[model samples]
Target: MARFRLLADEHQARSPLRQLWREFARQHSAVAGLALFSAFFVLAIIAPLLTPHAPYLQNDNLLLLPPSWSELGLVQYPFGTDDLGRDMFSRFLVGTRYTFGIAVITVLGALIAGLLLGTLAGMSRGVKSSVFNHILDLALTIPSLLLAIIIVAILGPGLLNTIWAIMLALLPQFVHGVRNAIAEQLNQDYVIAYRLDGANNLQVFRRIILPNIWERLTVTATMALSTAILDIAALGFLGLGAQAPTAEWGAIIADSLDLIYVAPIGVALPGLLIFLAVLSVNLVGDGLRTAVKKRREN
Candidate 1:
């Protein structure tokens, strides 16, 4: 009887997650986006094996070779070679790692910092909360990209610095979202019950508040991820990011401007990847929001 009851309890526990997956799967656009993003992730993981040549290796003889299918192209260079004769396809594959990796890292960093600050503000009152709220407002007043650029300029440009800049720029939104969510949750019946039951502030926050607000946080984090990607690309485009031979999508596009006419594929491929990545993340975020809403309604 005990084993049977345990099995039944486990099934019940699994039901909600299964329902959430069903809800997500019902969104065709979200599924498609997931597929696209998964493909890119796979490519990034297998890039070393897939790349035809070292991304930064320059072959003077193959300079500006168009894609293999192009009438003007060499069969050896599939997506073509850049002006410097580095393999476009190779650089692109490797770039998936840098571009997506940085975006994920930046978003996670911002989310952690924001969650801490927001939690503190939400749990406090009067002066402390006011200070946090005002700081968040001040941060929000600056345009995200411009704020990132300013930070990058001050920190000096590099992949790490760019990630930090973007993370800092994104922090305010997460903080604001979390703070509002926690403040609202604190007023809820469940939170009040927990408090009345002699739960400590930390206990109430951990067992009641965090779970209640996690769905909103998940949606916000996904949206923030897309913004981080775009910001990283923008920083790279402006010459304040990933640097030469680094194989970042925006940096590749920046370098290809002069070769636009000579080899349009060089410029278009990376831009297309960036577009697809951002679009995929946004689609996923929308799907998550819809699914969570439906879950709540049920």
Candidate 2:
């Protein structure tokens, strides 16, 4: 016991990620969040294959069936049916695709814009940085969600429209992250040495700044995805996102509001899906961040 205690103490001296996962593994919140999200993502990717019934197909007999503990007994619809008699489970499964789709595109697009603008701004001073930074500052000051609503209003409601809106709204955050990281590294000795070695500006950017900054943006991109997903759902709730019968998580919530009493899981199901999706991405992001920080420290 004494020797074991000494060894344990020595091992505990390592970085947090090494220690954190083991400690966090026992947590139901983290476990359930990861599992739920993985399952949800799989559902989204393989939606066409996994769904037992066509999500859009209507069955009057099964309309408004409550969540089934066992095959709906006689009704046979799982997790009941929506107002239009479409299977809630199947719609929810398919909706994962729509929700994740919007989130992924918006976040990825925003990452590109932020990374380019930020890299340029950070590597520069004088008027160039000022021009780019002013834009970033302007975006940062505005509320992203409100901006999304306005943009979506102009673009009109649709999956692609909401994605574009959210993508624009996400720009400021990436700019902030990218700018900070690049600014810190631009002044490093290695950067100056490379410049002195006759490396062209583009060459310097490719070799020096980007390699170091890549991890930051990667983690940021993942985190942004979570927010983007939420934003998409919000748009859906407001009827500014995926159209009806699209089975998006947010649209599901909007539809369920009218039928909350009749089929609560219609509400719960989508809500659960979104919450889990966001939570999982966040947890994984956290893990990655911790790992990165530890690497930097070491």
Candidate 3:
């Protein structure tokens, strides 16, 4: 059976995607995390239909209502009502859009910008590379949230500004990682051999470098996504991100601070969602990193 399994693995190794999937599937926690993340993503998409009431609708009578399962709760409000009498469940559903949505947009923007800048830095020489590395190092020295705060301070508070701030804050890591990855690949014998074999820069990059470094890129992206989510929420909490009527998770938590004693669950639920989303993304990243390492070793 071991011999057969080895033969099967060898066959799968011919296809990197299949081998990656097989390795990733072996991680139960990662699979669970992927499922959880997918659920949140889907909910964010369908939140408008799933919400029991208008997320912004307010009723003084329902203010601070407990969860449906609680004694003082109503069946109509599963997650209860906020201090403003808006349905907590509805706000949560809508909030998912802001949290995940903004994170996705920020990460993608950073990834694209990084790929372009990192490629240029990696392919350049002397002064260009030095300048790029120095800039990245300077940015890295500042904490992401602090960098975002500085940016938001300049741009003024709002969801759009927060997105730009977080994207800018997250850009350096991707740029540095991609630059290092490409530089490392360029130093390898395979790249040198390809160049000698009449391959142009574009051909070598498309055929050899990208394939070799994609797993690392995937891991970095997953991790960055969680970071973006946290950063967005943090900015929102500080009043430098999504503002009132936005239903963003962090803003929701901020609004609930005054009513924490009366409606502790309001804060707890959004906080829990953020925790879960970050945990899920981290788990996926860990699993991908492990799979990539194992694949390389074998």
Best by TM-score: 3
Per residue, candidate 2 scores C-alpha lDDT tens digits across 96-178 of 78898667767888998888777777778898778878888887888778889989989888988888899989988998998
Which candidate tops lDDT? 3
Model 3, span 1-298: residue lDDT tens? 9999999887877787887888889999999999988888897788899888999999999888999999999999998998889999999999999998789889999998988888888878998789879988999999899999999999999999999999999999999999999999999998999999999988988899888888888899999999999999998888899999899999999999889999998789899999999998998899899888887776
TM-score of predicted structure 2: 0.85
- TM-score to native of every candidate shown: 0.94, 0.85, 0.95
Q: Order the candidates by TM-score, highest first.
A: 3, 1, 2
Put down candidate 1 lDDT per residue, 131-192, tens digits, no spaces. 77898899899988999999999999998899889999999999999999999999898888
| lDDT, each prediction | 0.89, 0.81, 0.91
Instruction: Name model 2 segments beyond 4 Å from true.
Output: 1-37, 70-75
Residue 120 in candidate 3, Cα distance off native in Å = 0.4
Selected candidate, larger TM-score, 1 vs 2: 1
lDDT of 1 at 72: 85
- Span of ten consecutive residues with least summed lDDT in model 3: 10-19
